[model samples]
Target: MLLAAALLAAAALLARGLARIEGELARAAAAGNRPARVEFVVPEGSSARRGVPPRLAELGGGRALLGTPEGELVVLRRDPTSGELELERVYRLERDPERHLRREGAPLHGWFLTDVERERRTALREAWERYQSALAQALEDFGASLPTAEEAAAEVARRGGADRLLALTGPEASALQRRTAAIGLARAGYAGALPALLVLLRDHQRNAGFFARLCALTEELSGLALDPARPAEALAEAEAWLRAHPVRDPYARKGAASAGPVSPPR
Candidate 1:
């Protein structure tokens, strides 16, 4: 009798676990199915069980569901207020190497709802787009190779390019863009903008020699004294440059790679 009772108890525990899994699956489908830990893109109004694109996973499939190596699903939908597609939800999945969900396998084979990292790249996308658009506009306005190209480019700067680049250098920008903006400013003869690049390091405790090698790179472009020694003066120069001119893509210069070779400060 005791042996029979123990077997019954085991079966009861298994049934409860399966029920919990079923509930979780229902929730995942309703929430928009996708694995939370894996970085995958899912379109709005699609079923995760069907299949979705995986960044670097070998695709696998089972009788019940499609799977990636990591096992999960993602969903994206347009925000009504913003009218932009945002990452709507992510669902969990069993780490099945087969890369497919097995519905017949009962409750253990599919998605769960647990992830903390916000799955969205909207801000990064927008930032990169704006930077590219501005560069393109500036280059178009400058129209390289004209006999008076310098004058034209300088005029574009005064109209607004210079001030715009400086504006992007503010703390509001991501470190990547800020570095690019500062380098552009330096190449445009605004040595003062080098200061903006320095601040991105986020390490106030670093000594002088370390900073000089870093800023030394841009010092070549501006032709002005970029002494990290006197930050007050550098800032003043930056402000003055900001007031006077904007950014221009000096494509006339030989060997200018898109945004120049400026790396972000470490």
Candidate 2:
């Protein structure tokens, strides 16, 4: 009798868990189906040779639905007073030839309706991840091109600040490479990477001689002098300066100089 009671309790718990899971899934689905924040959409007309022309149907009460031949359903809801048409939702329908036609009364144009934002966010995330991987690979390549620690120190001692980082060790080369990358990032409008670059600037693993070059690079880009040894304080100061004087993307500016090798601070 105890064993049977215990089994019944286990089953009840299992059922409750399943009910909770179902509720969570339902909530998730509802959230996923929420209306998309649309930018502007231009009508892309289709020729007879190109296939079926695009369809635009009014759902009454200042609400219009546009069915693109490419299986995109856009719901546009206009303001009652202002008459400004705002995009309510964007859904990618499953490929159904019959449903693509103008139907009298249909729940939806297709069987499955996938939210555009979810798909877009997923794709953007994947692309961003790929970009991060590429950036890491580029950094590794830069590091590979550098000389050994002993060689870099000797080179720095001989040439000082005027000398190009020609034969530096891996650690030393990384510092110069990071400086160059940081400069490039600043020029390219990747201000988000500033913190990472600042961390790299103060890394103890890098040769001490490379700090001046890194500091010089930051000063050149941001007009804020960074003490290479005290990266934490330097980063805070740099951040404050950046908040006041934002780094504008030179590339985006008209008649800006083309990107090239970033020279270290002399």
TM-score of each: 0.25, 0.33
Which stretches of candidate 1 lie above 4 Å from their native place?
1-130, 133-160, 201-213, 221-260, 264-266
In model 2, what are the clashing residue pairs, if there are any?
Answer: 147-168, 147-169, 148-169
lDDT digits (tens) for residues 20-54 of candidate 1: 33344444444555432333343333344266444
List runs of model 2 lying over 4 Å from the truth.
1-49, 95-110, 143-266
TM-score of 1: 0.25
The total of clashing pairs for model 2 equals 3
Candidate 2's residue-wise lDDT over 79-140, tens digit each?
Answer: 66774456789999875647745666654546768898777667545544443354465456
Worst 10 residues of 2 by lDDT: 249-258
Cα error, residue 152 of model 2, in Å, equals 32
TM-score for predicted model 2 compared with the true structure: 0.33
